[model samples]
Target: MTTIVVGVLGALGLVSFFHLGLFDLSSLLRAASNLRQFILETFPPQFEILPALMHAIWETIQISFAGTLLGLFLSLPLAFLAARNLFGRWVAGAVRLIVGGIRTVPSILFGVIFVIAFGLGPTAGTWGVALYTVGYLAKLYYEAFEAVDVEVIEAVKSTGCNRLQLFRFVIVPETANTMISQLLFMFEYNIRASTMMGFVGAGGIGYYMVGYVQMLQYQHLLTTLILTFLVVMTIDYLSLRIRSVITVAKN
Candidate 1:
């Protein structure tokens, strides 16, 4: 009876999908045609724009690294306050509210506003990315703090360790690995977001891509794409290596 019911539900889902035109043949054909055109147009990336591309790529990396580091520094105290085990309930609630409010605003909107306020430069992009990253990293770090072993905390308390000492000796060590991992993840995301901020004149590889595409320079756009890919991949690889080393050390 259960198997029959499951099969019926699966069949109904398939029927609904088809009814919604999820598998429309014409849509597939159109997508294929557009993809073919894009492929034909964007080939053999322009090597001539290497100097400009290199500059933009460097700016993108700087934006990402600076923003991520700023966020990490700002988030440390906020994460401690937000952690249930670290702060009183009221303090934790207040910290959570602030973090939540910051996160509710989209990062792109932050970038746009910063561009206007700071007058369109990498500084604006740095702050925008940093603000977004703080919300995310603070939340992750708080959760890590919360997940620390209660017994270890109690042991430290029994030794007459004050709140600050307990935090230093027990909580920080317990969550250090997780915090590093979260920072790396946030850095990876910041690299991607920095590119988008360039659209608002925040000075990154994305700005160059927009300029090139608008000028109908498809070859340059392709080269920018390749360069961005290589840079992001290298950072991701390094982050993974560091994370693995940390994990092994902890074990």
Candidate 2:
């Protein structure tokens, strides 16, 4: 216990030394004053920019939907091929390696690459979100596919079903509800990600956010931020309701 306490104190000390920097009261007070001034400038938010904000919100939804659909389409085949029950060890390992590598890459990097490839706009953002989602969702879905009960798979096989038939009729059926539910969750996550894609010229509300910051339009910036928060909350609430209904139906 004494050794553990010392170790914990050492860890905290290192974190304070490196991460927190010096505890300067003057710096803290200055930051707080700046924050107060910023808030005062942001009061009531610029309601006049509602149309532009709405349009950006719509575009964000579009990017998320398109990307998630693309990921789902691409992930399904790769997931089955990577399933140990369906493929040889070498094939599965190679596929998993590729997927893992993709997941290791940051999403913003994907946006940057796509912007370079396609030039600035929604196209770049859509592709970026799609590629990242493929990397992320494939791993989750492959695991779900692999977890399908062996007895159920064998039962289907006894009917003389081929591998493709087995997946279509048995595995997919068993996992369809889960797949749809997860896709909605992915859409919610991608909405937040899409907002920042515009920073790389990939497109969305982020450009306006940049503009507001550059112009010192604190009111407009606060409005944009609030809109984003509301949209995310709405998505979360809707996703929860939909998933609950799906779960009940599946049961």
Candidate 3:
């Protein structure tokens, strides 16, 4: 118990030393004042830009959806090859290593690379999101595939089913719902990621956000933020509802 307390105190001390800033009464008051001024500047949002904001947000949705679909298509085969339960250890290890390497790079870096290659547009953003999605979904899929009941797999194999047939008839069916759930989660994540892709000129509402910051258009920026918040919240709620329904159906 004493050792545990000492470790906890040391961890807290390190966190405070590295991650947190020293806070003083004056610093807090100054921060509060700055926040109040910023809020005042942000009010009376520019409703006139609603049409443009809507269009930009729609583009973001398109990028995310396209990327997620393309990623899902690409990830399926990679995941199948990476499943240790389906394939031998050597094959699974090699495939998992490739997937892990892909995942090691940040999605934003992928966006920057695509932007450079494609020369700045939604095209770059879409491809970047797709590649990132492939890495993520492949990992999720293989894990889900591996988690399918061993007894079921063995039972199917005992019936003289080939490996491919086993995967098709047993593994796929058992993991289909989980696959859908992960896909939905990735789509939701990509929406937010797509917004950042615009920073590198990959295209999305983030481009407008950058412009607003540069031009000091606080009112318009606030309006854009509000719309984005609402859209994200709506997507989150819908995803939760769908997942819950899927769970109920599975049960």
TM-scores of the candidates in the order shown: 0.86, 0.93, 0.89
Residues 201-251, model 1: lDDT tens digits = 987898988998799788888999989999999999999999999889888
**Candidates 2 and 3 compared by TM-score, better number:** 2
- Give lDDT: candidate 2, residue 13: 93
Per-residue C-alpha lDDT of model 3 across residues 1-251, encoded as one tens digit per residue = 99999999998998896556544567779999998998899899988998989988999889999999999998998999999999999999999999999888888899999988999899999999999999999999999999999999999899998988988999899998999989999999999989988888898898898899889889999999888888888888898899888888888
User: Model 2, which residues run further than 4 Å from truth?
Assistant: 2-15, 18-22
TM-score of 2: 0.93
- CA-lDDT, candidates in order: 0.89, 0.88, 0.91
Off by over 4 Å in 1: 1-32
TM-score of 1: 0.86
* For model 3, the run of ten residues with the poorest summed lDDT: 17-26
TM-score of 3: 0.89
What is the model-wide C-alpha lDDT for candidate 3?
0.91
Which structure is stronger by TM-score: 1 or 2?
A: 2
